[model samples]
Target: MNKKVLERHEVPVADTWDLESIFSNDEQWEQVAQQFKERVSEIDEFRGRLDESSNILFRALSKQLELEEQLGKLFTYAHMRHDQDTGNSYYAALQDQAYGLMSILEQKTAFVTPELLAMDPKVLDALVNEKDELQAFAHMFDQLKKQRDHVLSEKEEELLARAKEALLASSQAFGALNNADLEFPTIKGEDGKEVQITHGRFVSLLQSKNREVRKAAFEAVYATYESYKNTFAATLSGQVKGDIFQAQSRKYNSAREAALSETHIPLSVYDQLVETVDEHLPLLHRYVRLRKKCLEVDELHMYDLYTPIVKDVDFSVTYEEAKQKVIEAVGPLGEEYVNRLKKGFDDRWVDVQENKGKRSGAYSSGAYGTKPFILMNWQDDVDNLFTLAHEFGHSLHSDYTRSSQPYVYGDYTIFVAEVASTLNEALLHHHFIETLDDKEKKLYILNYFLEGFRGTVFRQTMFAEFEQLIHAKVEAGGSLTADELTREYYDLNVKYYGEDMVIDKEIGYEWARIPHFYYNFYVFQYATGYSAAAALSKQILEEGQPAVDRFLSFLKTGSSEYPIDMLKKAGVDMTTAEPIKQAMQLFEQTLDQMEELLEN
Candidate 1:
């Protein structure tokens, strides 16, 4: 039976993360915020003096970084507190205040970049050579110089900056509608109990062994989205339009180009992922066939995709057991790494229970000055165990990066961020399969691994393809009405999942509900990151200490280099199709093992 979700206050103190480290209390936070507001003019003082001397430039940069760090701390705290219970008006107001202050800060410091860009390249280079402190910003300046064509005049830049809030209106509206207003109907569960569908509960219901329950839950959730299809389509269309407008305003050819250029990733990498995954569609079809056979079903519907084919395995894992298992699983990373994991586990770094009004999913989040904290609605199951390990991966990555690099480079890019988290999940899976001796248990574990690969690599690649296609359509002046979006999505589903499975028409409305589509070409990184993690995990398992050293170096490097360069140091080249191909091969190998185990 499913347990009742608790209120945030009802959750045990030890089960919650300690946010006091950010500020002693809300009073202190308010004081700091007020002081920051009073000192906002400090950065404005360096307005036109950037070209005067290297020391002046260094001082200005230092002040800006210092203020940014403080703002990060304030904003991170406010946002996380708000996420704890979004209905809390106090934290909501605090979050809004922080956002407003951040916007004002941006406006106040708007002249720094354009002023720096106004200087001659030779003059800037000479200034860098004049002071040792200025050397840290060499890459920053180089990247700015590269954007010389895109950077507009001072007034234009300010106008664009002011337009950011307006441009984000669509995304903000979607979030408000989806999270705060939209509600799914209550549906009968496997036990014939009425359960209100929520984002958190939907996953568990989809994986139910009861086909009736799964179908009911699936229909109920999408039905809500279908009712508001026009609204969702409008929001998504507005978002895509915003991307196109921003790209054109900055003189880029397309939205995809502008998005990828931010991370310095080549357009070829995105194209290659879709192409290689397309080549492997037959493998996915084969797996679907296997799934159909394993479940002894005549027809496999989209709702059946998440159900476990292997049953009665008792794959329960408690939070305590998960903690020890994660430590042991990551033991190959050396004592220091394992010790840090243990520290985070004991230091109340995780908020470990689901509660009413809490955020639906899980994530690792913190500022540079605070502990790397993780928020989870943890379940005592294998999936939650892997999630625990996954979040720890992010926390540990943050821990290492913040400790090793300066605040300016403390945080890693989202592209490389998933590599560490997914790598941890991969390592935890390996540990389970090797250490568990029971045949049925091993089969369950293997199934879990395959399901993860399918969701991360295959499923996310499908999303990537859809996102790219929609952007192209918008760029080409095509309409993206609800009907058009649904047709395109359904066709892509058929192409990716093959002819064996029934591509349920309702699943096409799936695009109307995904939060990531609003993220503007960001979903592709999940597939790419998983592929990189797969290759890196293989190395760590086979090559031992040397590979671990390289992976550790990757964690510490942070944003000091480009994301692609950082992954290259860890020995994974995402530009080529090798990593995706290798990940596909591993998926096939796992399928083979599952087939053999079932045959025996």
Candidate 2:
């Protein structure tokens, strides 16, 4: 394998995303940035007059959203540029400038929500009833009204809005340290050649057939983090404190409440995810035991977890093959979906390779008016193929929503964000199962599916629990010192993985590296969303067109309805534990299939 890191400019032009669609050039972006800053203050002119007439209120709302949409495009362009090459000073400055513009815009528009909340309920309702354009924002109005207690006075709101950039500093610092600054030591690859560890390549290293290489990669990565544990802890603690402060300032009982309340999700969903997944810990333990037996190892460590238990079954897929497989995987979603998916591939909506200082992991991102472009550190493997399908799920969801809904509902809350992505993964898994005939190859695919369950469902739930524990600790006046954080994280691993696996001490330092910790109660949705998608995917597979239609409708609905209600309309009620339990049942059946294959 070529271990050379390509400079951003050296990466193939076709492999890169089309950010030029957002802004033709940096100079154009600059001119628009300047014009946007000047016009942002125009929001101030309509502020005090929101309650005067329905027409006045409509204009205020329209102007704020218009400016926000423009700001989204600017910030999206700048951030994607920065992400493609974090070491680039120009893009970094552009990102910072975009953030500054956002803060200013936030301050200017801060009065709209407060002023609307200040008006009499009857008056607000009557105004909405009066204007057809205003009716499009009925959902927004309802959300604002629900958050009445949390909406501070206009001046206070503006103060918090002004602090947005500052509150984000710790997260930004962590990103800089993790993505751009810290360097991992060279480790021997499976072939005994030295390769530098990178965020993009770390997991693939762990999946090596060579145990010693996996162990070295795992320990080397953690040890590097261990040296910087104190710095990570401080940044994480600062972020937690920031989250708590924002939550408390907004009259929330806890940071989780503040985060969840945005989508009107009941806390029970989180609690039940943890509780239900805990109940299913025995299944994870059983899977771990199966993994140990399959690998014929005396002791299974965390590093051993990623290697395929079924030996010598090649599942590597090229980027082109992945594109074809992904397009085929979603064939159940109908021709239009397939055609659009093909278009995304053809249009260069995905940035498909790891380059020097590029952001790690995969994400689907774009502004309301733009194609939902994807960022991926492409590797030739099934995991990357699955990731391709997963990200395309998000992109297609964005495509459908943007095409179907108005700007007000063009995007979705994060709660439902993973559903479309994970559902695509499920369909891809199903496609593999139906097509593959060889026992060993089928075992490889099954191993991949089970590992997906382990990672997405069990692993993320563990993250959710850890996130909850740390936030609660800070809320209880506890400090998240390095030792304290590491201890709690290690303990959670022990509880989640059970006695069948050795919980490595180096794994405790794992918390220091997770970027999601900075996202304030965001990781739990992966677990919940995966569960919801499992149920929804099963429906689409079994019930045919009606289920497909319901699922497609859910995608296009966007944020027009509450997330829970949207899922309910799509035929799954996340408020209940049934979806999660249903997902676990699927996990058990898949495990059963794997065990049967091994026995044969």
Candidate 3:
């Protein structure tokens, strides 16, 4: 690790984020908090009157959703602020307080959806008929009805809901330990310096040119996590048990069903992703072997994974240069997109510097009534520049969706959220390849593409698979003890890596480290989303406007329709295995090119 206490970036406390735009001061927020409590208590007034008449029911439901919208804006602002600065006790208290109130408010309106669905079928139809706004929520309403079938009596529902507050302890503990508590060993860098091992910096360090440094950092990291595996596993087992308990309690057929029911996605989509990826593992294996060949190593250990075949990305990009590079790279997106994206970046919509207590990782987050905002610790490098473009893809998608869709449907699901960001990355990668005349630079870009596919598609899929396996095991009346989860996780890593590479037993302890598994089948969507973006990137490159129109429609789409149906409008039918297969083919082609170039 090369570090002399890296100068961490500062969070923009100055004209940085207009959180005050949501609420100017603490007094205003307190007033809103009291109003939430008051309005939440008023839901009982509409108890049985939901079926009385369409107008009354519509007014009642709209009021409930309106309350939610206001609450969402308030909570979103508070949480985003707190997420950026976890150490800020004031914002943290506000977040915890807001979250508690939201929970209470959720309980107050708990009966609304179930009660509405439990009504005579004619009432729901009539309500849908009278108002288009109600029609817009038909899918959401119907989902509630679906839940009604599985729901126990109101008392039973309340009991399960209350139990959930306790069931969440393990995952919460994991988050605290991983992000805020755990520390790692320091490696003496080639430059005679030591760096603090961070979750964010670890990946870049593993890509270090020095094998000893990479090995030292990699071994040191797992060593730290390994010593604590038992605790992690216990927490992990609790997480799996929690998933199983909820799935069974809710009458879901299985853990997968419970997880996918949110998106109403077909089980085949999950099955197909696994199947397609399994069929294509050999390509990954070949890439692995070729990487070993390129490095001329006797054995490729886990530590060797990040030692780049192409040693360094020598090109340095300043903030301004990065902006221009991203702009030129995405030119195939057309002049309109180019102009709007440039304006958005330049207009202070991005918090473009890293600072103390600032959040790690990048995201585009804003409510319905604001310019889509992005936050980044924008280092002067090619990576941060592309990170900027990638997040802008998310911001622009939010901008379009918020402007076009109503509050009820403004937010898209996680399944499609990565499509825009990953597509931006793919386009930028291609743009970099085309613009560079140096072969080594071209090789560097190719290595980046390979690493990305592996990280986003291959590694995430492995995570998704392990998540499902453990959840299924628990749901099947089996206990996923710490030992069992570690064993299962290790087996999957060995299988995926094949006999060619060493799978350190310590890596099996990974199930304890990943937070995404607790998200309940959420990780698979990232793998699928990247595949979809790769497919779309090919479209935009080959058939400009028609493809652009399809993709823009996807960007504008929110939750108005099911994820699968909305994706169909964008020209890729995700329910089938086509997109995954197409992406696998691209991965193979990239590997083939990788080998030929390396040998040259």
Candidate 4:
């Protein structure tokens, strides 16, 4: 019999995260929350007086950071509490209260930016030089200055801020239609039992060993998307147009430029990724050809891509085993790094199992002052083991950054966010491949690594390319009608997957299901991050202490340096194509190993 998910209270105390460390109890949270709300007005006192003196400005910014840090802890605790048991009404209310407090804080601090912009540059420079406290925020002020050309007047800024909700209408409508209203067809499972398709179950269904089940699930999903093609097209077009409008309003040359400018990433980095990956398309094609051979199918289709090229091999790893494996896997990072990871494991920094109404996926979450905690709805599988290592990658990154940098620079940007996580995964992959003696088990691990690389690097690069094309098309006075969107997406798939795999007609509707298209050129980071991680992981393994120290330095630098520069410090120059090339070399090496193993 399958085990029943436990109630929140019934979950063992040791297995749960020590959230009481955040606040001894709910009553204390309530008391702190009230104090936080009362202090919201404290920011308004510095509103008009920001230009008074450097010391005053320094204290105002410092005070703002202090309040923000408090708000972060408050929201983090409330959301984690609610996530642990979504059915609990009290925590739900607390989460809502935290959100409300956040809005108030934002509203009160809205004047700080415009007021700073209004100050004389010479005066601000003098102030910054005058105060030692102000000097710490020198990088932050420089970043703000870069926005001087883009920023509008106080009145105009307010107008744009107020229009934020209206701007999100198209994306929100797509979410409602795609998530709330769409109905998927029921199909027979591997056991010949009828199972209804869901967004969550769709990917697993495609991974089914039964080819017929995979094909049916694929068709059913695309058919639903096909029915709503025109509507989806409209929503997507609106979202793209809104992005362009926002970009033009801010004087950015294009939506892509505007999106990338936030993280100081150069357009060449993105272009180089596409160019390098395009040059290495044969590597992916070779993998697809291998898949065709391994499956021994008459023909390969897009739907067949997700199923394991290697059949079942027992790789079950209990949570305890996963923890130990993770610690061992990261051993190359040095004793200090391993010991920090051990502290996280021992100090109850992870919530390790699923219970009724808990969150479905896993993540690392916490504020600067609190322990960086991980949440998991874990299972006894290789995937869970990798996930444990992946999340600890993030938690340790957070731990290092918080301990090293001030609160203002504690959190890193999203561009470099995945590097540490994916690097950990790379390390774990290496650990498994080196340690496993059984060929079948090693093959399973090899297939897992290839699938991850395919999804992260190849697939996401394709997405980034498509995002660029769509925005450029719309900017050049073209409409993204259903037919246009479908044709472009289909052609791109043909280019990326090569002629070995048959591109299905329904695959044109695949773009409709991706919500990231609305994310304003954000998907490229996945491709870039994975490439950096692969390269950095290789460096750490081959070069030992020097590479590991550089990688650790990148983690601790946080937002103090530009993301591109941070990766450079870690010995991966994302500006050049070397990282992507290095990653491609790894993929080719792995493919060669897998083919040799199967042949032997």
Can you give the lDDT of residue 76 in candidate 1? 87
> How does candidate 1 fare on TM-score?
0.97
lDDT for position 386 in model 2: 96
Candidate order, lDDT descending:
2, 1, 4, 3
Task: Point out where model 1 deviates above 4 Å.
Answer: none
Give one digit per residue, the lDDT tens place, for model 4 in 1-600: 013457789889889998998998899999999999898788877978998988789889988999999999898999899878766779868987887777677667777777888888899999988888888888888888878888777666656665665677797677657754676888989888888776546666787789999999999999999999999999999999999999988899999999999988889988999999999999999999999999999899999998878886556689999999999999999999999999999999999877766655678999999999999877676777888998999999999999999998999987998899999999999999999999998998898898889988999999999999999998898889999999999999999999899999999999999988988898888888998999899899999989999999999998998888888889888888888888999899999899999999
What TM-score would candidate 4 get against the native?
Answer: 0.89
Query: Model 4, 438: alpha-carbon shift in Å?
Result: 0.9
Measured by TM-score, the strongest candidate is 2
Which candidate, 1 or 4, has the higher TM-score? 1
Candidate 1 C-alpha RMSD relative to the actual structure: 1.5
Instruction: Pick out the ten consecutive residues of candidate 2 with the lowest summed lDDT.
Output: 1-10
Model 1 worst lDDT window (10 residues): 1-10
The candidates, ranked best first by TM-score, are 2, 1, 3, 4
List candidate 2 segments past 4 Å from native.
Answer: none
TM-score-best of 2 and 4:
2
The ten-residue window of minimal lDDT in model 3 covers 1-10
What are the TM-scores, per candidate, against the unseen true structure?
0.97, 0.99, 0.92, 0.89
The residue-level lDDT of candidate 1 at 225 comes to 91
In order, what lDDT does every prediction score?
Answer: 0.88, 0.94, 0.77, 0.87
**Could you list the CA RMSD of all candidates, in the order they appear?**
1.5, 0.8, 2.6, 3.3
Off by over 4 Å in 3: 1-17, 25-27, 145-148, 160-164, 316-319, 347-359, 370-383
